[model samples]
Target: MGQNTDRRALVRDRFDRAVGYEGAATMQRVAAQRLFEKLQERMEGRVPLRILELGCGTGFLTEKLRNAWPQADIVATDIAPHMLERAQQRVGEGLCYRIMDAGEPDVSGPFDIVCGNLVFQWLEHPQQAIARLGRLLSPGGILALSTLMDGTFQEWRTACAVEHEESGTPDYPSAASIGEWYPSLFNGGWETEACVQTFSNGRAFLRHLKETGASVPRAGYRPMQLSALRRSLARFDAQGSVVTWRLAYGCFQKPPRAGVFITGTDTGVGKTFVSACLVKAWEALYWKPLQSGLAEEAGDTPTILSLTHCAPEDCLPPAGAFQAPLSPEAAARAEGVTIDPASLALRMQEPERPMVVEGAGGLMVPATETLMMCDLAAQWGLPVVLVARSGLGTLNHTLLSLEALRQRGIAMAGVVLNGPLNPANRETITEKGKVRILAEIPFQADVSAQSVEGIAQTLPSWADVRGGA
Candidate 1:
């Protein structure tokens, strides 16, 4: 038999024997709760969605879904029949149960939402499963899941080195790999938030893995030699030996209704500031596709990197970086370089992952001879998050910007008012522009990490962006 076939049998047999799965699986249960909580916060006050949960092990998450959305149609499934039976017993009413594999699910769906908790690690081909789930979603539908990432169980691997080489944990994908994969698979907004959980001592970690029914290695069971265990124990820190579970949870859609495009009524209007805040808040990748001014510490990309501590790759290098602090066209001309709209139209490449793409200037700023920043945004098909000043003259600039965006058929995700508060301007812009004010950011005393986080909290719920339809 093939590796994947053997893995399937191993996974099934292990979970079938895990009768105390629920009692032992505390971390998985907690992570599932967190994933659902985020989904509720993101989808607050929206209509009840038809939800399909893959890998519904023993119904811990299924019960949570039932309580959260009693009116919504939910179907839960697992590869292990014994686990499915337990889930069926626990979730009882309002849920359809099945014994099916998530990697190659037998069910049919145009589901509003497809989610799975701690399930993707078992799949032989996670990319294929994600593509399958993408097809199952209705247009504007979301597919959310939590899965183990590449670095999970690092300490255990270190401790039991010999056994690990022979029979280690399943191969988990990296968060970066997942983020990169989405662009090719779906045309929608996606966001990945990563976290690490630490457990004291190797034994406790091993016990936790068993209780969660995640103890099965890809190659099947292999006992660690007692000598190996003793050697591993000697490596623990004074505090305790630690085991880490690296997890990535996220939400994405197939055909995006919206994406967050940060542009301001004018340059130096805190567009970069607001973009950084959104990047931190959503755990999104940052892109400044056309950086006109080239300065070491003054570029928008640098400012975002400083604010969010994002990886350098996550903050993409611009397609055109000119020396002059002028519009993309003028700057390109000054530097004896040509800027092409076709070259700048790279946002379409990865439609699935949620990203914060900062525009060069106001809506009508030109990227090329015929292509304005607004045109670029419309081409990308992302919603605009218009940044405006909150004081005098803002109403006019903001309204004019809004009109320009509307004329280009670009959707406005919302307006973010920057600087000192001016209730009158805010009210006038909201009333006249007919747009929602997502956030009214106060004057910041500093631009440190703590300050940025505090400011991010004030922004409207990210749910409002919803890949602007």
Candidate 2:
């Protein structure tokens, strides 16, 4: 009992003393971003209504979670009160902050997601804590984490070995052992990223570790004598030392739920129009994960609410809102940022009320440098409701989009067409694409709630659409 308390105290003190942690914590920030992206593989189409984060030191990871899901109720906790204070300062308002440890997390449950970054290595019993975290999840919820793993700090270890001294770096779990940490009932998986950081010399390297609160070794680790420490430092500097931080990204899912992704055959293809019709028709919730042109036009959230007359709360805000009237990738780059489509993943809130997720641009459009709109839709695991124009070259555009969706194995929630009804175009699309048309409505001179309701009346019931999907 005394040893456990001492370990906890030492860990807390280490972080509490790290006053300049934010600037020096490059590894932590990178791990947080990668962890955020990695989590989407396990949890697609699930919007977490509630999220609990452990060890949110200085809020680097906390800030990412908040930006990705601004609508979620996130609670960020840490072992050190000083660190929690810094986190609140970094993330500002709208998040719940607490001074709590991940080893013995104290909070309510049924959260859609529970996560931590670089916290498990400090736990007294990491595997047991993971099982406890699993118990806190809602049925279909996930517990995601990124931790420092074994084989870290190889350069420092080698230098110490050459100098006949003990290395201060803590021993971490192997990838295979981390795999065994998941409970028998939970479905869990992990992958690793090798991040390299080069320092001018051994002294600067030690300073970086101290500033980031990662200098603390294991409970029983012994410090080297002054002579030995100096010899090891000289050896490290002579070897042109480079530090390696192996981040193990792990996610454990309880189960999963559902949602629908709305995309277009091409840009300006009535995606918002069909999305609003669905929202008004099914009385569903609305979410547009990526929104560009905010500087020039009225955002989709307001448009959906105005047309559907749904409660403002029913329409969750976009994960990313960029200023330029350009593609998501272009706009994000303009603002010195990049959009990750995986950041759009969400756990379903109310199973009864469906969510209409509208995408920016068409299937082949890029959300990031590597992630296409079709790729995002597939990662979300939502059956897609493709929106298209009713005439002209829609035959080619619609068929191409359908082929892309099919290639990714994304389920079809059918199609909705805009503009004047062209029976020939509709027939050709359905016949060639082998897909159903859910609705075909005339072009609206002025879109309003009444018009949206009228279009809704023409569409089939949610059950019918869902069954076909």
Candidate 3:
């Protein structure tokens, strides 16, 4: 058998022998409780719901879910039959306990919710499992799960290194990896909240893992001798052993909402202003992935906040920044850094809530030597809301911008003309470009918060763009 198959068999045997597993899995229970609360927040009192519970070991999450929503139809699944046997004994009536692998879920679903706690860490390709789980959900359904991320066993890893060895803990996913995978896996937006937990001492931490049946070594991992382990434990710090678990609570909704990437014909063409107006109009959050001129200017974030009267939390910090006012690539080079355009990933928040994202400059602006600003938009899979001027030379710029987006296969949400209303230019761009004029913002003399709010109200709903309504 292959490594993953062998690992699965070993993990099943470990859990089968772990009698009284519930009492030893304190951390898992705590994580499950938090996940349940998040599920409640997402459901918002909707009843007669259908739920699919992954890795329902010893009924830890199943029992809690049953208690919370008695009327909800639930299917509780686990890879280990022994674990499912215990879960069945604990929760006899409300749920269907099945022996199922979460990574390759075989059960039928169109479920309103699919939840798993401390489960993804064991899967060989968690990103694939997550994508599969997403497919099982009904339209507008929610996928909420808590998984162990990288940097989990920091102290243990350090101690092992001191003894010229490796820690036996399973390799977990990292935050950076999750940030990259989320965009590709879920076309709909998603968000993550991270939590950390600590233990008393090295031995106690190891004991917790063993009693909870999670201490199974990785595929092909060799066990260290007792003497070597003792020597490694001796290196534990004075403040007690620390196991830093990075738990990412990810929430994604199905029938995905469309996200709009707001780009302009040129820099300083009111992209931020348009973004702020959209935020005010739709109550959507604003994010700028790359900010190049932060050291010299207040930047887009402050401008968005001031113009929208939105709270500080409404705007996310730029993913990459530099001191120079030049293009992102040039600024990064000036600062002795190479910008990896693929490295800039968006941080999602409640998928149901819409968001307006602003790009650094024009559609063809270089983010890196090999990537342009439009490439980032395409990567995000969001429709483009082309922001253009309403004056002379507008038609050529607008047409070229639209064509660039089309070549990249990025969907056009619609176009917004930001300056004085030009009947002829607007008609020409819409007619020739073959895209609707979603809105035309009359040139504002004051450009105050109130004026921005009024303009926001004049804009069409983002749903019209997303739903192609």
Backbone clashes under 3 angstroms, per model: 10, 5, 0
For each candidate in turn, the TM-score is 0.54, 0.56, 0.57
Tens-place lDDT per residue, model 2, 1-469, is 2128877898899999998798899889898888888766666756789999999999988988888889999999998999999999989999899988787877898799999999988886888788778778876677889899988898899999998777978888888888666632344567788988889999999999899998888657789998998899889888886889988987766534435789988888888888998888788889998899999989898999888889988999888999999989999999999776567776467865678889999988888888888877766656788899998989988999888876565657788888899999999989998788988889899888888888898888777765411
By TM-score, the better pick of 1 and 2 is 2
True-vs-predicted CA distance for residue 33, candidate 1, Å:
1.4
lDDT of each: 0.75, 0.83, 0.78
Order the candidates by TM-score, highest first — what do you get?
3, 2, 1
Candidate 1: stretches off by over 4 Å = 1-3, 162-167, 183-201, 220-223, 234-239, 256-469
lDDT pick, better of 1 and 2: 2
